[model samples]
Target: MANEAATRLEDVRANIEKACKPSRREPDDVTLIAVSKTHPAEKISPLLEAGHRVFGENRVQEAQQKWPALREAYPGVELHLIGQLQSNKAEDAVALFDCIHALDRVSLVKALGKAMDKAGKRVPCFIQVNIGQEEQKGGCAVSDLPSLIELARSADIPIAGLMCIPPFDIEPAPFFAYLAKLASDNGLEQLSMGMSGDYETAVMLGSTHVRVGTALFGERRKQEQ
Candidate 1:
């Protein structure tokens, strides 16, 4: 298991380098967030042992249930929340995540602000955009993005960048380009876009962060949460 984890991590890093070369971007420019959601600690530890420090989770509660021990065991592991957040769980989210990739609505902004104040810890956030405008997806509408960005800014939440999950099963390059443009227009630098299947395309388009899971962990275990 440990050898398997290290080999996968190495392969992913090589892919990142290959993606960066044509664009004249350095491999170091992209942060690979190994998405560990639904996978247990036993699965995650090998990657940790292989020296991967950044990981992503889909839910705050699940992360709360699993990450404390992992964090204690591996100092410097950075946890990012890649799922939608509820206002009521702001404090818990603030306590657990090092960064948030789905800060989309006004209430969450307010809640996180207050939570940060109370905890004396500020968590940086990525304003999630509904790049494909899918009704079932969770992200700020493109038209509403400016206001939401402004609102998060007003509340003094650290804006890490913009994040989006482009509509699945379609060519994703255009959506990724559009997201890069939006980030540029907003004066933001980090972009939390791409996943296992399309991260190379995302890297070519200037993604600063890629959330990859299946390629790194093989597949997620059944969710018990």
Candidate 2:
């Protein structure tokens, strides 16, 4: 498993380098937070051993169970929450993850701020924007971003950037570009959009972070949890 993971990581690194070079960017310019949401903790140790320090999880519950042991074992792995986070779970989320990537609304922002205060740490977060405006998605609509950004900024909960996942049928660049503009217009510095299928396009459009899952771990086995 360790050898397999190393080989896989090399493949990803090569792909990222290729993707970056064509766009006149370095692979390191974009941070790849491997989305390990469904994979078990033991199954991911090889990835950690291979020097893949950053990981992303879609839920707090799974992370709460997995990270405590993983952290004790690895000591330097960084966990990122990359899913729609309920306000009620904000405290636990902030206390556990190094970054939260799905901060979608002002209420969540306010909740995270209050939660951060109690945690004695200013938790970094991204304002998720529904750039595609899909009804089934989790984010503030693009039109509402300004006000949301304002509210988040006023609270000063470490507004690190903007995040989004484009609708499946469309090209991700325009949506990603929209996020870059939102970050620029609002004077924010990071763009945390794109994933396995569209990450190259995202890198070309100046995405600072990409959440990659299948491309890194292959297809996940559905766990009967």
Worst 10 residues of 1 by lDDT: 216-225
Q: Give per-candidate clash totals.
A: 0, 0
TM-score of each: 0.97, 0.95
Candidate 2 differs from the real structure by a C-alpha RMSD in angstroms, to one decimal, of 1.4
lDDT (Cα, tens digit) per residue for candidate 1, span 1-225: 999999999999999999999999999999999999888899999999999999999899889988999999999999999998999999999999999999998888999999999999989999999999999999999999999988988888999999999999999999999999999999999999999999999999999999999999996546643
lDDT of 2 by residue, 26-142 (tens): 888888889888788777898999989999999999999888988888878888999999999999998999999998887898899889888888878998888887899999987
Worst 10 residues of 2 by lDDT: 216-225
Q: Give the TM-score of candidate 2.
A: 0.95
Best by TM-score: 1
lDDT of each: 0.94, 0.86
Error of 2 at 180 (Å): 1.4
